[model samples]
Target chain A: MQLKKIKSLIEIMDEKNLTKIDYEDKDLKISLEKSNISELEEDNEDGWIISPTVGTYLDRDKPLKVGQKVKKNEVLFIINSMKVLNNIVAPRDGIIEEILVKENDMLEYNQKVMKLG
Target chain B: MIKKILVANRGEIAVRIIKTCKELNIKTVAIYSKCDKDSYHVFLADEAYCVGESNPSNSYLNADSIIQIATNTGCNAIHPGYGFLSEDYKFAKKVIENNLIFIGPSLDVMEKIYDKQKLKDVLKQINVPLIESYKLKEFIKSKDKNIYPILIKQVNGGGGRGIKIVSSPSELEQTIKELNKTLKEKFDINNYYVEKYIDVYRHIEVQVIADKYGNISILPERDCSIQRNFQKFIEETPSSINNKKLLDEIKQEALKIFQFLKYDNVGTAEFLVDSNFNYYFLEINARIQVEHTITEVVSDIDIVEEQINISDGNKNEKETFITPNYYALECRINAEDPNNNFISSSGKIDILNLPSGRNIRVDSYIYQGYSLKPFYDSLLMKVITYDKIRNRAINKMQSCLDEIIISGIKTNIDFNYEIINGKDFKKGNYKFKKY
Candidate 1:
């Protein structure tokens, strides 16, 4: 059988969402197997507070400083997105190692705003 | 005059718009999601900014972030390129509310065109032939057996989602119940209508450009009949309909509709032509389409530039008649496994070679080492070929496809090559192929 025919058979299997297919005809016999693609990502192990949405970055009323100890769920910063202010809270109890962003800076989603140590 | 534009889109369309802005001496601002930060569109723009996460809702479709970026950058206009917010009436209204020019149709025109039912009603007023449709209650009451294979569709649906076909009377009620569930879950809306489904038909669309003034110019009709899952895979200009009279009629009806509505910017009127050559008006797309490249290749016109000009209130010279100079065809090369049910194939592009030369054009955003993200559409690039004859155009496209190579992931390039060389395509007898 031609390679094209086998390729097409694989397409039929995928379109049918089947993992395997077998075919037998008067003069032709074919079997195909398909392996699904695995989707996985490594977790971010380092301590980083990423912005959740695109907005204007602003400091809280009590400005957070480097080396400051923060409790989990404490409001660390504020992001004014589309006129709605979103509180960027600390994910866990840690000391701030670095302040990556400044006041009134435009921040993008997943951008590193600060680092915890 | 529009000085700067914020392209509220990504991928090839965003790159396509920014290229035109460069030619027209207009600055551009591109917004990218977190994953797209390293993409080509970001580097092509005069200024780029990160918007949100990789997901569309928090990124490309985040109208507020897009508008804020445009305003903060001092851009005079916002070009919602094709997908995200291009036909969004609410976003267009918000752009105007923020004192920025929305580079497409006006808010009122978009409002009517976005609603498929309303657009059909307006077409009916102008005597355009329309497929019979029924409201939910009326369809249930008048479940005529004649129209057995009826199509159920969302009133405000796109991307070919939540559409179902009932082939027999026994399957009608059950199909409706299942379709309603899908619609509610996918679109979060219970509103839907039933229409007579034409089993076999050709998809033909007319491209029109209109300014704020009543001046309208109609281009050649495009045959987008080759499709899979309702998404167009191949498109060509100067449809092989063989009946000049029928083609002319389709173009005339399209002109009349646009002239009546006084539509602004560039838009396309789609139609479904049956075996008898009887054409039924489909809804109009209020923005540029993915296949606009083929039309541009044949007509030698920059549609994006025209869009910007119209948005700037520059009047177009009234030209009622325009003809194509060549035959053009476009094949979309998607980063998907055609041998695996077209599932998106995403990975880093280790090796890449794109075709070039005369009568051939490529519009793409992929490059060497570019990682194909699963969070976006699978369209990798578009390869277009044009010649004075259709046969030559097909031949050129075949060679173009052969010259291309993309490794590290699967692509539909081989499939597209087979399609262009298929007997049905060679004889110009291809219709909407069921995949």
Candidate 2:
């Protein structure tokens, strides 16, 4: 996707409050999320990654610790709720600024787990 | 000892439960649908989660998800505040099986009361004043004289739906045909029952509280006769019956029904009182009722607190029970426009000028700038007033209704004002109408 076209698409999404949009005929594939990017970008100093479900925190194997560099979309930890595992991923590329929780810690839904910025 | 609780219902009732929990130093966990993100209950809870989509079945009624969230959030108890899953015995069983307390009546009370037939049978053995009921199958099989103007109701379960009044023998066959069709299509059942319908009756219900130790306390009965289409709109403490003997008889009957069911926690036994002072047993509501606030104001008893203490196995009841020395009335303010054929009106509340000052209590979740959703019940708030006399209570309630001003969406405030101002309501001589 062209930069101008993507910017216009983002503007349209913001105008209409659209969460995601995709257009493809032969080779173009794209998806944009306003809640993740636009909302989180306002607080850039500490990009807090919170649990989306109430469950027991189960850190992924070989998890990145505090002060460690991490990348966007990286699997940081897992929340096991009702026997279902939910992967908590980094919303953006950043370093592990702080680890707010430890493995096997009981977490309420939306509880802060880590800070990556 | 429930340190934390999850209010598995929403709107005003959830807010009510959360307030009660806060006072008891118990943390509250709320679950809401995506549509209810801005709901007051969600904002009031110590913690909240979006369990499912907006649909009731997907969100509030999602038993598995609700239980899972309660389990994960460390909620020691789940209070299904009236309606929804309050009377659902299976949901209560699920909560119990998961080691979480279900804050309501016992399993037997829930199971028996849910099946009207079983509850009726249980009440009958204990000499509870019950209106005679015959199953559809049995009535069809036997040769008996038909009671004119009978109430046709489903035997397996009871709901406002699947209820009709058959006036004469001419409508018996047709009423049965329609009853069977409605039962099958609406309830997926083929069983039903019929009871003799009285022409004029006043709706009275007794508020009963039982402890885990089986000590039961009955509050002075409330007259909820002011109803529209079987849905109570106004409820008042200190029933209209003047005869002390008759009132005591009704209260005794109510206690008997509660004991027979082994009911624990807070419950209400409704009755149909005829003009001649005869009362018959109606269904039992095994949860905190909507009109409990009126009884609370009059009796000076916190019913919700009592319910929590009972669920916690606390046995002290004599200290909490008090004879009501005041008269109180609750007017349900709904988001409905009476001039518009009572159609539900939903929009952002622009300004909320509820009645304030002494002797007035408004239990509501709506505030200025709150947008109401059309997916749920139309009730907006309950305006209650307390005084030493019924006339004073009624006058105070009328003034309370007069001082209300909700501008954005239409409200039934005016309709309630008319009812409170009407002669029939003051005399307590009105029957249920389709107003």
Candidate 3:
């Protein structure tokens, strides 16, 4: 396998909660394992968060207002670069646990754009 | 003037040659591999035909198929642009045997210069200084006193393949063995030669054009010292050399060598000039070079047209054309990452924003949906900038590169910026080895 593809696979393994992955091709052979991490706990008090493309996190503009309700897959914030633009979305159906980003905020790829319980 | 021509290659160079043919009012035919069904060259040509599969061995290098297509298309001539079968003497002979113009030097001339060792020996007889080499036994006997860091290069190779450096006597055998294995695998030849490696040598080449009736012209020299892995990254005309006499001597020696071989058509004579002003003959590229655009920009001459004119039986006088008021530089943008060993990256070009401005010329066939092929050279585009002064030319090139953008595949853009902004390059004090 190409070295770049291998590095990308490692990144994917680290990001997701998967036990193992294997791929084979005429010119490539790959096997990957993920480190043990806590399974995401579902909580009614928690909100859903979605990732755009994979990257790092930036700063937020403002804090969450108390008692605000947020729906699942709702637009939370935006992450961007000179060439790419990605929007963070609510992950699950829940109330806003805590608003993460401000009005004009920066974020990383796969970095928690918002806190989803 | 030639009435019709066929381009026996594909991709950017073929498209480039077609553009010039259009300007000269010469009808053009293009040949493509199956993988290049939607290539820009096909769209640009008056007519195009598929030769074979994407693999170059069955397609572009299939001289017989290409000749047959040319014959069927009623093309009177064929132009092999810089790669594939461009320098294949047998291909040239086959084309000529079909009673069509080859648009390059005769096959006999190509045979004399195809062998690197033989070419070096010939240049040596013509008084062109070259790095001295000893046989394997002689090298072993003189290891203690010989140069400390010389290159063990495959005798029949070019393009930096099958080359290794032997820094000390202890590493000589190991390096030679590895290099021999590589040469055998890549070129099917085991012969190699050793030469004194000049660390701070500048890569300079003279562009010469010859007609059928013995007329030749030496265009201005180009400094291609900014290179990586022996492949040129940046090239500029009006080299930083200040010694007029020495430059003239080098050009004269190159002309003498060309005359000795009776080489006709467009060719480049390369040299490695060291810090002490000593120049060593490198090799001759029988086909047009990748950086030929820089020479064309500085000299204001269409090299493709010149080749066609020569092939059409036009006779001209021997003369040296100098760059009048402007300097030009070219950057070869490839689909490779500098930080990752320059490995070829293949994917669809989702977005491609080519840089443009006054004095900027971008020669590329990439489009928004173009797929970067995995089977061919990784060169993606040639970005060139020109100005009246050297620094201006450099700045223009930097700005142009800044505006350029590509997605879905990695490139060497960052490395190009670093090289241009580096202090050594800014002062023009760097050599080809610095890359």
Each candidate structure's TM-score, on Cα atoms with residue i matched to residue i, is: 0.86, 0.79, 0.74
Could you arrange the candidates by DockQ from highest to lowest? 1, 2, 3
For B1-435, candidate 3 gives per-residue lDDT tens digits of 578899988878998899999999999988877788788898999987777677888778877667766776679999999867788788888888888999888787889987777778777777778877654555776646668687777665666664676788879877657655765656332366677777556888999998766677888888898877777888888786667777787788778878788888899999988888888888898888789999888778888988888888887564655544578888899899877888899999998899987999999988888888898888889999998888888888889889987999999887888788878877777766646
DockQ values for all predictions?
A: 0.40, 0.16, 0.01
Note the residue pairs that clash in candidate 1.
Answer: none
> lDDT of model 1 at residue A111?
77
DockQ: which candidate is best?
1
TM-score of the A-chain for all models: 0.62, 0.65, 0.38
Q: Pick by TM-score: which candidate is best?
A: 1
Clash number by candidate, in order: 0, 0, 10
Please state the Cα-based DockQ of model 1 relative to the true two-chain complex. Answer: 0.40
lDDT against the true structure, each candidate: 0.86, 0.82, 0.76
What is the Å distance of residue B116 in model 2 from its true position?
1.6
Q: Which stretches of candidate 1 lie over 4 Å from their true place?
A: A1-47, A62-74, A91-97, B159-162, B180-190, B199-201
Worst 10 residues of 2 chain B by lDDT: B154-163
lDDT at position A63, candidate 2: 71
Position B389, candidate 1: lDDT: 93
- Residue-wise C-alpha lDDT for candidate 2, range B232-251, written one tens digit per residue: 88888887656668778888
